[model samples]
Target: MDKSPDAYWKATLRLIGTVLVIWFAVSYLAGIVFAPALNSIHLGGYPLGFWFAQQGSIYVFVALIFWYAKKMDDIDREFDVHED
Candidate 1:
């Protein structure tokens, strides 16, 4: 099956939008906005919120980077545009 450029681009854009939303929620909402509430929780003797602010988000970001690359490859293959 073949995909038009418009459809492929739309898929790419949607993937980007989804990744951005996830990144924002983890980095901003969890790390800062909800930090106070999350402070009640603990991980390895440190506040969960603090962990998120200092380290968790970075880990999540790196994971997302890999996930995004994998997803992009999948999308490219689906659209028959992937490099071999």
Candidate 2:
């Protein structure tokens, strides 16, 4: 099946939006809104909430970057838009 450029761009944007939402939730909700409750749990030497704010979010963001790249590559292949 063939996909139009518009469809491909929309799919790409949807993937990006989903990734951003996950990033926002981890960086903001867990780090701020739910911090006190999460603080009860420990990770390594820090409270879980603090860890998310300081380190966990960064790790997740980096992982997401790789994940996004891989997904986009797959999407490009599916759309027959991938570079050789």
Candidate 3:
């Protein structure tokens, strides 16, 4: 069965919202709000908080890019809206 355009777009928007929330949490909450607590732990000689504030968020963002693509593909297939 195929979904209507409204349903497909609703799913797409939900996915985008989910991704954005995760992005914001990792970038802001972990990096800024919880930095002091995270700083207690160290990774590769750098404080974990510092790492998250600088590099971790970047890495997570890149991972999110691929994750979002894969998720979008799954959503497309589920809705029978896929290109192929």
Which of the numbered candidates is closest to the native, going by highest lDDT?
Answer: 1
Cα error of candidate 1 at position 2, Å: 6.8
- TM-score, candidate 2, is 0.92
Q: List model 1 lDDT by residue over 1-84, tens digit each.
A: 549999999999999999999999999999999999999999989999999999999999999999999999999999888999
List runs of model 1 lying over 4 Å from the truth.
none
Error of 3 at 29 (Å): 0.7
- Residue pairs with backbone atoms closer than 3 Å in model 3 (clashes): none
Q: Candidate 3 residues 1-84, lDDT tens each?
A: 548998899999999999999999999998999999999999999999899999999999999999999999999899877896
Worst 10 residues of 3 by lDDT: 1-10
| TM per candidate | 0.95, 0.92, 0.91
Candidate 3 lDDT at 38 equals 95
Give me the overall lDDT of model 3.
0.93
Off by over 4 Å in 2: none
Pairing residues by index, what is the TM-score of model 1? 0.95
